[model samples]
Target: MKPSGTASAHSDTFARDHLPPAGQWPELVFDLPELLYPDRLNCGYELLDRTAERFGDDRPAFRSPDGGVWSYGELRDRVDRIAHVLTDDLGVVPGNRVLLRGPTTPWLAACWLAVMKAGAVAVTVLAQQRPTELATICLLARVGHALCDIRSVEDLLKAQVPGLRVTAFGGGAPDDLTQLAAARPGPYRAVDTAADDVALIAFTSGTTGRPKGCMHVHRDVLAIADTFAHHVLRPGPDDVFTGSPPLGFTFGLGGLVIFPLRAGASSLLLEQAGPKQLLPALAAHRVSVLFTAPTAYRLMLDELDGHDLSALRRCVSAGENLPAATWQSWHERTGLRIINGIGATELLHIFISAADEAIRPGTTGTPVPGWQARVVDSDGEELPDGEPGLLAVRGPVGCRYLADERQSQYVRHGWNITGDTYVREPDGYFRYVARADDMIISSGYNIAGPEVEEALLRHPDVVEAAVVGRADELRGQIVAAYVVLREGAEQSADSLCAHVKSELAPHKCPRAIEFLPSLPRTATGKLQRFLLRTSPDPHGRVALE
Candidate 1:
């Protein structure tokens, strides 16, 4: 019952009304003509319906590890039935917010399309998130409807506010989505929503220890696929996509789902997509394009045993920096160069990446086509090549936080200042240094921790590493490390520290090293440096023994 604005607002009044001030939004630059979307458009119509029409209706869409492949026609029809149920059966109105939490299944994908098709905004949450985290998201997005799988919806059920229309999908519930779709699955007209209507709200992992909701519109969804997937990935109808990212992670949403469907291609959805499971699924499904984190790739290499990865043509690594050692090792083993890139939750997906021959090992390549990026100083002035500074990016899809004061900090003077510290080469390749906050300043010297970590990773015994600044009364802060070493390898802290000294300058070496069984990482494979800063047993670090 909100007042009608430029776009229809059937019931999504909370989100639209709570959006940050217009002046606070970054100056979105849509230089590419393809970035311009029609006023009234539904992404479901574009990603599902019209795609089916273009590539014959029966063309394959999504394939799972077990369930048979779903054709574009089948997917579109399924989405329509779900949309019909949302609007007619559940009283879901246009612009209403719908929450979706479930395992990475084809049904969840269907629900995502259904919500948008009904002109409602979709809030995709990680299936494994804690109840408190889920509740915070529910309250922030003001979700009034939820469609979830019974197996993993305990938190969602607890998180949901009263008056929420909950519909279970799997687990054989009496009113599950499957049972309802089985009753009446057919054609349902998609709402003609304004391109500006918010289609989804993606949440950040709170690596900074605080979560923020990022608002993306219908056009924003397609813009990412057009820029990153279309230009860099170059997937075709014949290609089969598969990956390890969760649907809630924008990286997964873009790589696993949007990219393939946009190119008339299909993807393999794996419910338990660990490194072990991925290898078998990749060969069995003959997956051509693989999407996963650098850590997963490193783990896959360990268990390769000459596994048949010949079917893979494009292997993309994001969610964290791809170490030079990991990239080289993956190529040496699989004969495929891992495509490295840097993306952010604020920018939707990767605005900086390169594939195939464009890749330069150890660097995250150049800014993605249709986007502009540069290294900037503290004052927002562009820095010269080879000088490490903050990475500033401006594109069609940029920072749009939901009613958060951090909007001003993230989007300053029109550019989205990604917290990443990067060095731009003269040839335009961008090398990641460390996060701006992750930089360690000691005794009037500035050090990038990733630089030291990269050198440490070169050691044959080192498996994974994370570098952070530990407080030092004498030097203000010192370079400290939490390393995961290969089993039965050189476990001495001095041996590793001395090895780092051989590779980097004296100041860059880890002043203190602590060997760990595993480094802390987010579900999407991003290192959690903040956790290291607060480790309770800091006194246990090796004292250069």
Candidate 2:
């Protein structure tokens, strides 16, 4: 049950061995080379066709929470029918953007596939988003047609965006996707999309302001499947993939859609993915590969004693840093090491992750194959090993943010500066420091909020924590901790503050603590530190804080 020996064993080879002495790391393994496309088509339609042909009707291609299963042949046929509906019935054509809003159900998946098959761009919106946000994304993407779930129609109607044609899935006939699938053609030719043709437009959380649409080409999906899947997950036709990420998020899209389809594997889509729902679903579906965030893993470990997780062979964690404690605890309980990676919405998917056998606790292993990364100073000069600096990367797939000057600021000299501070070791592993904007400058020392939060999580009483800089008259800014304690654990504010002081360095401990019932999170389950920074409880309004 030890950290290194718990999962599938492999060699201890480190990425440092492959690093170049001068400029960048070369010969990194990527995922795109392993795909099987009919002809040279780069669209997702080709990927689905290849999967159907390879797997046929052998097993389920997709499964739902209620045990509804669709074989590859059945799924492909439905996708074709939906494609016809998109083109002939709805007047959708190639080059148009179709806004797709729904949960992670089979219909959503089918609609997404059908959109790409019809040669239109698919713009995915998170199901949990409010009507305002949904409308904002729809307008930004200039969507004229929509394929949505029955539940989300109310919200869409409330948004009242004009010139939008709506079609519901799961309900019967006319507008319902089920009836359209039954009546439409079973076989449709795949669109011959170019590699550079835009396939999807994913919007980021836009913590600074309005969400920015990230345009990804057909090649990007194939590139991610080839880079991450071939090198990291290494999934096969028999692997049963399951995850908690929503289909709207790139993490979910890559793990649940691209990875499984490219590998000819089956995936389970859960409309709700809390620990309660996920644990039982894992057992019922016999999911072999699990993809989720660190917080969910910690929650699962707390409640997974009797669950049959023996079927789980791989667990991938992203969205946030994975604590060494959570990684070790899960491995001990489930005998699976959670593969940790650092991916950005702009980058499409994971560009740095550890292979199963090469995982090092507390590190975002190495640059993904075909990608090169370096820690550099503000001037873009590469820093020596172990020096904390801005993490810059150059890879096959890069960011093209929607009409934002910030994109240029982030992408400099062909290397995309992730705005994250990191420390590169002699062994080629990168240690996350802090987001450039999130670093707390207190008394001339740079304090990383996430690092302090990670330390706080090691304490048994603390269930969740968010650390940010608070305004201070003397120090300009001081570390403040917003903590959520475990159930049945009671501690005074003073005592809890003292507990953190005892566990961490005096300077690193929070200057003040605010006990909260729960931490604020984005729809994707990422902690929202921006909200915490603006709170008066931390400190009176101050620029640095």
Candidate 3:
């Protein structure tokens, strides 16, 4: 499909100008009728105001643990007020980038919607980001204005982004955004933005080097909901959604905000949603649809003894590969089949997944409705079934990095090359092997780190494990395991290595083992294998000499 030829609604054309060259763009397939959107579409209005109009205004939209519930009408009103403040008070122009830094809350969500409603692009960064990271994002996105939570303002201010205007919120000061928004006590009209206009720029998590900004359009936002949520998740209006991801991540934005609102469902937004807090919150809020990582599901299993999970209906897992053992263990306990998916920051949300009876325990399901995916070799040619290769996807949405050279590397031959190795079964299910960079080559033998990690997790005493390749003199690379054992378990390194040897091939067994209290994980609960691979600590290290 060609780029939209309609006139743009943005006054500042930086985002549109910085988009990848038209020739380099991936082939976008909009086979589904719902994927076709009108030229003038403001996602904020479509998700919030339109939803409130369809569902009764009094229907709940957002909920807090403190019993605070914002009806769809109230949320629409708040978003309009904030939008007014952005345009009238802050002097923000259409297409200008606005930084949003804060924990997951209704107010933070409102700021995001307000930015879109005002026709400015949102650059939502995680609240846990430090000053250096904040500076990098601001510089890359060319952000000028920010709406930060009062508590998280220190780092953003410390970053000293040049010529940046900062607005504080959640503080009761006169200059706080809440006070300014209250002064404009009326409805505000949303910007008439082109469907292809950039609505947000999501920066990569920087797992390796510097982050790349992924630019997504307003239509891309609605497409995720219409395709994935409509066809796969199949959520109902009465369902209450909740998750552990911060809104900064696309996974969280889709699961908590876009999906629920598009479905006319309510969501419980939590600022602190670890496994410990998730157990009680699930029951207390009567959460029906749960979105989190595989590790959290494993941890929640240990605490499920007293929790009433009858209200929990749908569970979705992404971010990292979901081991089959985790899936079976979770299903054995809760009677719910976790929807496993694979998505990337380049793509706005999940493009491949399965739910309910269609789920294959070990596979990452199939291409989502309206999307097409397959495994391809280094030359971008499709690989035969059962051969591990690069995973490529193309649909209504694909990677569009803003003014970045990496855009060519991510999209080639009209396919978004996700940096993960996968195998397509003859039955059409895609099984994950490992990240292309995370594969360990020991004595010329290809070993997927996730397979080793999955083997370790199956041990009764093992609570968590992360496998990586350590440089060795004799062997090209040795498989090393970092494990966290169950409390009070006295499993020695020799015993754990023997267990792994029994489960996997002798060559795949971990030559070195290091026990730790917990695995290093990102704020979103993704295991940080890069840290394990780079750690210089040698104390207490055990090896199969």
- lDDT (tens digit, per residue) of candidate 1 on 1-545: 11124565446566677777888787787788898777777898899888888888888888888769899988888888889889878889987889898889889999998988898989998888888888888888878899998887777777657677788988676688877876665998888887778889999976777799998888889999989888888889999999999899999999888888888999898888899999988889999999899889888888988567778899999898888889999899889988898889888899898888888898999988889999999899999999988999988887778788999999877789999999999999999988888999977799988888888888888888888988889899888888888889867777887888898888787777788899887766678999998885444365532
Best by TM-score: 3
Candidate 2 local lDDT, 1-545, one digit each (tens) = 00112221112111111112222211222334453322235456656887777767656889888888898888888889999888778777676778888889877988889887777788888888888988888777777888889888889878878898888887665758778778887888866665555678899965555788777767668878888778887899999988899989999998998899888888999999987788988998899998898999988878896788878898999998888888988888877888999998888889889967799988988987867799999998999998899999866667766555566576666677888899999999998888887899989888898888888888888888888998878998888888888898875556655666687667777777777889989888888888888878743222223
lDDT of 3 at 21: 92
Per-residue C-alpha lDDT of model 3 across residues 23-128, encoded as one tens digit per residue: 8899999999888889899999999989998988999999997879999999999999999999999999999999998999999999999998999999999999
- Candidate 2 minimal-lDDT segment of 10 residues: 1-10
Q: Poorest 10 consecutive residues of model 3 by lDDT? A: 536-545
TM-score of 3: 0.98
lDDT scores in order: 0.85, 0.78, 0.92
Q: What would the TM-score be for candidate 2 when compared with the true structure?
A: 0.91
Q: Which candidate gets the maximum lDDT versus the true structure?
A: 3
List the candidates' TM-scores in order.
Answer: 0.97, 0.91, 0.98
- Best first by lDDT, ranked: 3, 1, 2
Q: What ranking of all candidate models by TM-score puts the best one first?
A: 3, 1, 2
Error of 2 at 483 (Å): 0.8
Clashes of each: 0, 8, 0
